[model samples]
Target: MDRKHRGACLCNRVQFEVEGNFDSFFLCYCEHCRKDTGSAHAANLFSRSATLNWLKGRESVRTYRLDKTQHSKSFCLNCGSALPTHDEHLNLLVVPSGSLDTAVDIKPDARIFLGSKAEWVDKLDCIPGFDTLPQLER
Candidate 1:
């Protein structure tokens, strides 16, 4: 049986279901990915055979394709959360890992575009971590 995953936008305005297992997971640190996610890297699951179905609030989803490039992203217009996008040219479905409400069983297969990674990325492991928001000096 094919694995199924459900997800929603930050505001829960949009919901979707992905059917089939992800063929690969990747942490992309390219400049374009960083700009798209506003983060150090983008965790994405890629599958060529999987299907994406919007279960609710489909109208709230908008896709942006970068002109003169294969880069593209789909997001919720309401909450500005990343959503899955299908690349017709590549025949692949790219899903942002964080958008999935369901737990992901697979780990990232690789980290790509290390040359474009943020300067602070290498020292991230040395930073203090907090379970929740910890008290900080102002």
Candidate 2:
């Protein structure tokens, strides 16, 4: 039997599920990925066998395809949170790791496009850690 993983947008308006194990997991640092995620990188799970099922708010899911590249992203219309998108040409389903509400059995296999990563990314681990937001002096 295949395992099912559930996911939702930040607003909880868009809910979805993926069946079976993800075949590939990657942390992409390409410029397009950074722009799409609005972050240094995108953690994505790719699966050729898993099936995607949208449980709710299917109408609220929207996708934007980059004009000149294969890069694209699906997001919730309400909160702009990333969602899953199927690449028809590649026959792969791409799911944003951050959007998952259920635990993932797979782990990132590699980090790609390191050349396009932000310079600050290399120094992030050196920064101070916090359990919660630090109070600022008034």
Candidate 3:
């Protein structure tokens, strides 16, 4: 049997499903994430972009494109809650952890765009922190 993930917006107007263990858990301090989530940092659970299929209320999903970067974000239109962000280049779909309907014991594996992190924000247990996206030698 395979594990499945489920979640929805505050009003339960929009719901979705994602298959498989979270690819990675990371805190994003990018401006797009900050403004979209209205928080210091966004708790991001990365998975395949295609896996996050809306189970219902597709029209309630709103998108915000900040700046010229193609990495725009989607959220619940009614609640203004952050949904998932898709990174086309990485083939990654980053789901806002708070939206998950089930409990998650996963912690952020890393931090990205630390330079852009809010001044008042403090380190949360000091995970593998990075000022920018971690570049792996591929």
Please tell me which predicted candidate would have the highest lDDT against the true structure: 1
Give the TM-score (vs. native) of candidate 3: 0.76
In model 2, where do residues sit more than 4 Å from their true spots?
none
TM-score of model 1 (CA atoms): 0.97
| Candidate 2 clashes between residue pairs 3 or more apart in a chain or in different chains | none
TM-score of each: 0.97, 0.95, 0.76
From the highest TM-score down, the ranking of the candidates is: 1, 2, 3
Query: What's the lDDT for candidate 2?
Result: 0.94
Rank by lDDT, highest first.
1, 2, 3
Following a full C-alpha superposition, what root-mean-square deviation does model 1 have from the true structure?
0.8
Q: lDDT of each model, Cα atoms only?
A: 0.96, 0.94, 0.79
* lDDT tens digits by residue: candidate 3, 35-103: 767888888888773377789878999877766675677888888777766676778887888888887
Worst 10 residues of 3 by lDDT: 44-53
Give the root-mean-square deviation of each candidate in angstroms: 0.8, 1.1, 10.6
Best by TM-score: 1
State, as a TM-score between 0 and 1, how close model 2 is to the true structure: 0.95
Query: After superposing candidate 1, which stretches have Cα over 4 Å from the reference?
Result: none
Candidate 3 wrongly placed segments (more than 4 Å): 87-89, 123-138
Clashes of each: 0, 0, 0
